[model samples]
Target: MADMSVAAPRSRGLSLPRVNIRAVVMVLYLGFLLLPIYWLINMSLKTNSEILGTFSLWPQNLTFDNYRTILTDPAWYMGYVNSLIYVVMNTVISLTVALPAAYAFSRYRFMGDKHLFFWLLTNRMAPPAVFALPFFQLYSSIGLFDTHIAVALAHCLFNVPLAVWILEGFMRGVPKEIDETAYIDGYSFGRFFVKIFMPLIASGIGVAAFFNFMFSWVELLLSRTLTSVNAKPIAATMTRTVSASGLDWGVLAAAGVLTIVPGALVIWFVRNYIAKGFALGRV
Candidate 1:
């Protein structure tokens, strides 16, 4: 009985150290991830005087003027609208095109299908710089340049491929027998895809939408190149702060902070779908 008791305590003792180590690692990782965000929030609350005068961990005089400026300014708000329109358009175009392409890749076998998949992915691998000039001239010639559609369609060049790859993985994880059964039950391809496959992979769609939103949200080069003052995105506005005098650090920082809001709202709404999406796809 004494030996048995000692063995149980020893086993627990061995587990305790591992648990403690994992806890410590997790704390450290969380700190690493959150520290920059903390600093940004901290800086946003400080005055320009305080920001330039001293380096304090906390604000000397907390102010809401930064947020006030962003909220009250038409230019700032208009940029938000431009960004929203383009981002949504880009996501819609990407997913609509990708869904059918991904379905084809997952369900059908065709000549050079695997090679085509790789080639599609390679579009994403190309640097944005390489495509910027061609995109600018192409859009300009067609009179699509400087419109929200131009930016949205340009984003599709990269986003569509990523959406296809991600959704394909999710679709492939679905059992082939499900498709066979649906067809056997007199379900047409359209009905089976809409009524069956879509519901099963709704989480994947959410994940793909989230990714497309994020990439297009933060993208600067394509957005800046595609629009001038009339349709300039917030990212382009951020660059205008750099003048002969210097960078408007305070306003720039404030704009940077505000830019995070839409992405945050998106993630907040879709966070529930992330776990299920991963589990379904094993991705």
Candidate 2:
């Protein structure tokens, strides 16, 4: 061969690693999405003077007074407790009502079935502002105003419809043969639904519960309109940060951060169910 083969290329002293375009894009997208949340936390750590006096990325004068005030003050901590109470109530009530309604819609064909489904969705689409006055007056007249139940019931107007819609899609995906099989096996409707059918649609229930909780937790107009001192939600109580001394930026930011924690925890726990719900064409 007379040494005709070319020698391998000599090693370079330095070489830049190839950049992953997708990873870079993902990092940038995450940064963009998280910037506001990061800023809120940053503001929470700073004093009102530091927050207003500077626009630094990190707090120059870090303080925990805002968090301390929220944790120590009954007005603040009770707002969080009130919010949780109503949100849990609404989620339970919505799922309880929607499950049967969804099953009926999925398994049966009846007059006005489709029309009724659409009507339910229309209620979800309707503005809360439209019913604010009515709900306020109704709750007040019935002596239900400023109670946890009032906010829970008010939220059901929207959450129940949404829960029904979502659960109906999931229920429709289940085979009708399962119901027939259960019947043949002597399983009563209630027993079959509770023991067999409910498990099959558990992911749907999780998705519905997550949405219902989030809607009820974050809904301000209805919660605020329906409640005052006794059942004031965190969303309503957050507004109290504004007073004669001007806006309490630090406390407001701290409250917002705390408010996001519950919904974030719910999403974390049900993330798998949410993914499955979407995959099942029910989200």
Candidate 3:
């Protein structure tokens, strides 16, 4: 036997790193999460009769009539416009008010500052239903009912606090030396905040804006209570699809699908910033 010892089989270098169990698990979890959304899209393209009478993994009779009606009808399309208006307004207002508040919390040591911060977070903890009646009564009495601004303002009650909390985390990570340096350079407070500080925390602002927009967009109770005709959001509009003849499932599904578009777009645009913020633990 040539040396009576065959060379041991060459090692395969640690068995070629095993498949990542965590990655496989995450992919399965995501697929499970998205299955219902896939079903909704599938239903949107089918007739209401086809939807109710059969159960299929995919639409058998796909059609675009549901989407066509939504696009062509003023009542249907205007709901999207109304929703966008308030959502944008709410996002802007929340970020505007929260930026200053967060800066104060993060950079200063005022009396009762800790208590105040706790109080602000408490507002976010409260349920929207708790304030619905009061909001309705007040907005109605003030002639602000059924207006876009009414919903936007009402939403600020919640969004502002959350925005402040998120922004405070980001602002704290920034060095106070920068503020002093800007002041030394004779940069006005407003100019420094807008031009320098804001850009430094662009990721935080993006995260905050995305949160504000999404909450205001999908909110049903507050938006519904705040508006009826002129400012009725797409969510409220979807309710009209129900009638004596039963639900128009196709149209309703289409509307629901459309309602997700703006939010999806906002997320897509801000995704990179959001990831950065989260990575930094600032969101």
How many clashes in candidate 1?
0
- lDDT (Cα, tens digit) per residue for candidate 3, span 124-228: 888999999999999999999999999999999889988998888888878999999999999999999999999998878888888888778878999998998
Q: How does each model score on TM-score?
A: 0.89, 0.89, 0.89
Which has the higher lDDT value, candidate number 1 or candidate number 2? 2
Per-residue lDDT tens digits of candidate 1, residues 153-219? 9999889988998899788878899999999999999999999999998878889888899889999
Clashing pairs in 2: none
Quote the positional error of residue 35 for candidate 2 in Å.
0.6
CA lDDT, every model vs. true structure: 0.85, 0.88, 0.86
Which residue runs of candidate 1 sit more than 4 Å off their true CA positions? 1-14, 242-245, 272-282
79 Cα displacement, candidate 3 (Å):
1.0
lDDT of 3 at 167: 89
What's the CA error at residue 99 for candidate 1, in Å?
0.8
